[model samples]
Target: MFFHPMDFLILIAFGISLWAQFRVKGTFNKWVEVPTRTGASGAEVARALLDRNGLSHIPIEVVRGTLSDHYDPIHGVVRLSEAVYYGRSISSISVAAHEIGHAIQHKEGYKALTLRHRMFPAVNIASGIAPFLLIGGFLFQALSLIGLGIIFFSVAVAFQLVTLPVEFNASSRARNLMIAEGFLYNDEENGVKKVLGAAALTYVAAALISLLELLKYVMIFMQGDDD
Candidate 1:
C-alpha cells in the first residue's frame, strides 16, 4: 500500500522513461536540422508511400502539436504533426513513414495491431477504474478489492505488452520502406534509426514500469494474505 521493494526498480524504470522522452525529442530536433537528400516534405512522403501501397483511398491530415503524428485506424486516416507534415528534414520523413507503417499494418491485418485495437476499449475502462480500486482497497484494508484491482490492472498491463510489438513492427516497416522507396539514402539510415529507435525506447520504458508495479502489488497482496 505504501511502498514495496519493487518500488526501487519502478523508480529506475520511470527515470528511463523520462530520459527516453527526452531522447526522442532531442534526436528529432537534431535530425530535423539535417535535410534528406531529396528534401521531400512529410506529407509528400506519406502520400507516395500510401499510393504505392494501393492505399490511395486513405487521406493524410495535418494534426497540431509536437510529435503528435498517428494513424487513426477508426477513421481510416493518417494524421501528421506540423513538424512531420511540412518539414523536409530526416526527422520529418522518418516520423511520417512510421505512421504510414501503422497504416500498412492496418491494411495487412497485422495480428498484434488487430489485437491491440480489440483490447483498447476494455483496457481503457479498466485502466481508468484500476487506480481507484487499488487506492480504496488499501485505504479500507480490503483484500477482495485489492484482488479485483489487480485483475483490472492486469488487463492494462497486458495492453501495454501487446503495444510493444505493434510499435516495433511499425518502425521496422517504416525503416525498410524508407530505404526501398528511396525516401532516404543508405547513409542517412542511421539518423532514421536514431529517431525511430529513440521513440521506441519510450514504449519499452512504459511497459517496464507497469510490469514492475504489477509485480509489486502482487507481492504486497501475498504478504498481507500470509500475515
Candidate 2:
C-alpha cells in the first residue's frame, strides 16, 4: 500500500508539465491572432530574414499542425505550420523568426547546434528503447533490464542538456534579428519577448519531466531489488 517518494514526484512533475503546456498554448493562441503593425505575413518575414542573411535558397514550406515550425538542417528547409506560415501576427513573426534562427545557426556552424545535431541519432535510439527497458525491468524483476533503462535514460538526459543551449540561442538570435532588421518596433518588442519566453517554458518543462521520469525508474529498480 505504500508508494515511493519518486512516485509522488513523478505525479507532481506530470501535473506541472500539463499545466505549463496548457498555459503556453493559451498564451500562444491569444497572441498568434493579434495582427502585426507592419502586416507582413510569417512566411514573408521568414523569407526576408533568410534573404537578408544570403540564405534565400533555403526553402520555406508550410507543414500542417499547430506550433510545428522548425528548420530541417539536412534538407535545408524551414517548415512552418499553417497558422505560422500565413498569420501576420506578432506571435507568428516571432515563431517564424525563431525557426529561421536555427537555419542561421546551421549556416554559421554554431557549436551547440552542431553538437545537438550529432547526438540526434543516438538520442533517438535510446529514447525509443527507454520505456521498453524500464517497463520490462519493473515487470520481470531483472537488474539487467533496469541497467539498460538507466543507460537509455542517461542518454536522454544528455540530449535534453544539449537542447537547452540550442533552443535558447535560437530565441536569442530571433529577438536580435527582429530588432536589428526593424521587423518589430519598440512598442511591439515586448509582445515578441512574451511569445518566445512562453515557448521556451515548454522546453524547460519537457526537460524537468524527463528528469523526474528517470528518477521514478531508478526508484522502481531499487524497490524491486529490495523486494
Listed in order, each prediction's TM-score against the native is 0.98, 0.92
Q: What is the lDDT of residue 225 in candidate 1?
A: 94
- Candidate 1 lDDT, 1-227, residue by residue in tens: 59778989999999999999999999999999999999899999999999999999999999899999999999999999999999999999999999999999999999999999999999999999999999998999988888999999999999999999999999999999988998889899999999999999999999999999999989888988998
> Any idea what lDDT model 2 has?
0.87
**Model 2 TM-score?**
0.92
What is candidate 2's CA lDDT for residue 144? 84
In model 2, how large is the Cα lDDT of residue 186?
88
Q: At residue 72, what lDDT does model 1 achieve?
A: 99
Clash counts for all predictions: 0, 0
Residue by residue across 1-227, what tens digits does model 2's lDDT show?
A: 23667777767778877887887788889888789898988999999999999898999999999888899999999999999999999889999999999999999999989999998999999989988987787677787898898989889888888888899999999989988988888898888888888888888878887888777677666777788
